[model samples]
Target: MSASDSSPELSSEIALLRQPGLIGCLAGRNLSAFSSQVQAVAVGWQIYALTHSAAALGFAGLAQFLPMLLLTLPAGHVADQFNRRRIVITCQVIEASAACLMAIASWQHWIGAWALYVLVALFGACRAFEMPAQQTFLPAIVPVSLFPRAAALSSSLFQVACIAGPSLGGVLYGFGADTCYALCAIGFAISALATSSIRLRFPARQRQPITLESVMGGIAFLRRQRPMFGAISLDLFAVLLGGATALLPLYAEDILHAGPVALGFLRAGPAMGAVLMAGIMTRWPIRHNAGRTMFFSVAVFGVATIVFGLSHSILVSILALMVLGAADVVSVMVRGALVQLGTPDEMRGRVSAVNMLFIGSSNQLGEFESGMMAAWMGAVPAVVIGGVGTLIVTVLWMRLFPGLRDLDRLDDIKPAD
Candidate 1:
């Protein structure tokens, strides 16, 4: 369907599935996300089993985050300057190779803690290039009018993967870590194949010369787009402060006195809620009050976080987390639409890189902040304080970015010249 086609079918989720190239991109996204999640579970279990140290597990995450922190901008430059499809395919191939190596090492019983860290870091570096290129695919292949629905549907599929992958990984790990790694390798290989099948309707335009100025252009572009800056930064601070997922282990064992099964439920709660919300948005796309809705969603996220922090019941905590997840998906869909629709195609890679950086930072630093505060005072107090901090950030952002707050429609946002 064309962007201008306003038939009743245009509003349906089936319309997006029918779009040429979209199904391949969606398949690629789902497979890659599932592989990453499965790999995460296997790595965490294997790392702890090998070293029996919490600190080593922490280093594993750091190993992954560090590459994303260091290589994202340069990767973004490469995405804009080269064939994005080829970059995505190459990264997935690298990821498949890394997974294969991990499988071989696990089968040989020769995988050490450092080996796991090295492989995880390799996966991270590939993600730095893969994400920005993959992110551009939706906008490049779909009509602008269908972008919001497409984003929502995409999030739904990813959340499904997130919810399912760990459970499957845990089951496969009982067979052997090698078994898990082998499956991950297959997933990555299939993801690469799926992405290779897509044909971009709006291919990346190579416009900028190879210069420092060109590499840094996304930052400059974001600076001029006030709404985009506000929306993205709002997510950064809100998530940074309100992140309570890092404390789930403590909450399950200490606060709620629940066991590992409860912990599993707690982890899955948010993804379940996110998937539900994404499905709702896919069916009934946000047509008006786009900005206020986003702000309201963030506020809801803070409120949910606070509730989860104060809850002594696992049921209450899980419910709070579900609300938090639902709220977060709204903010995410809005911010993603704003970022993709407001920026020009040539700059989308760089801008998406910066966005990915903020997302990565928020997740890593949020965990650190939660752990520090939990150690300093207590888990309850740490999470409560973080939730309250999120509320304060939301209020402050509303005043600072009136343009975003007052914004009305996602389709109204035009690509900056």
Candidate 2:
């Protein structure tokens, strides 16, 4: 379509993207996400190589996820009480430091499992703080008129980073672990520098007191919003049970015999599918029966995971992963819209903190769970079982949360009274 024929909304979104501040925010997010993906791939592969235990790989996930589990609420409050830019900058510096440590360990051939776990654990803590701070800071950089579009862009970039980072890291890892670490460290540094340059348009939010109620406010609110809670919780269980990402290393080295290079493509496959799905979704947005679509998508994800787990052929496994990724994006977008539109402004910070905790744990803890299960049942069996679990969860959750399943449109549901 010609520029003149474009819709006003499209024109507005394009214009908003042009703003230097928005560009910087988006770019920073992209770099930080990409860097994290690289770190995860390198670290997971290294740990597996050193220990050759599925449980050890699970432990790596536990080390990172534990901090998010422990500090997420406190971190949310800190973001409200402090300068988000400074908080973000500090987190980025810590992340860079962790990467530096990994580089040193690899170079000296002292890459013990415990040391790698400790560094990754530190990276997780930094991530805990950085996630809330960065989310808060996004709106402060753009005009209110463009904030929604910017938010959408930020979300998309995060997924893109997930798709890109591991692939790039896997490729770089073929050169050397040191190379992966060095490049990740540099990416973190550049992201921090870019973030430092964005201006915060708002003042620090009023601090919530350190009382029991204040800390528990988000949970209380979410409990009352059944449809929203249901959607979020559904995503939590579906992905948590069905996740096979933690098995990629095992597949690469043992099952598929793809090595690090093949692992990179395998890691990137889901993301690639997700990106493709996203492009299609963008052009043909879901306008009706959104909730049913989400349920269908999760079922697809489960089926795709099963295919990936069963496939002995590398190409089929990758294709299956891509389908899984695409299905996940649909579920995420549907659930995210429910959370975003249904949340009241007053509780957004706290509620979002809770949401982040759920989503992050679902991923990280799911990794740990997958690793543990693989160790017990064997990797292929673990994955297939998890996919079956996901399917079961879908049916159970649909029955339990009728509001979520029956809800048709984003605007139809009201926030709790």
Question: Where does candidate 1 stray beyond 4 Å?
Answer: 1-12, 45-58, 107-109, 201-209, 249-262
Clashing pairs in 1: none
Q: lDDT of candidate 2 vs native?
A: 0.81
Residue 144 in candidate 1, Cα distance off native in Å? 1.1
Q: What is the lDDT for 224 in model 1?
A: 93
Q: Give lDDT for model 1.
A: 0.84
lDDT tens readout by residue for model 1, 288-339: 9999999999999999999999999988888898899999999999999999
Return the lDDT, model 1, position 196. 92
Deviation (Å) of 176 in candidate 1: 4.4
* RMSD in order of candidates: 3.2, 2.5
Worst 10 residues of 1 by lDDT: 52-61
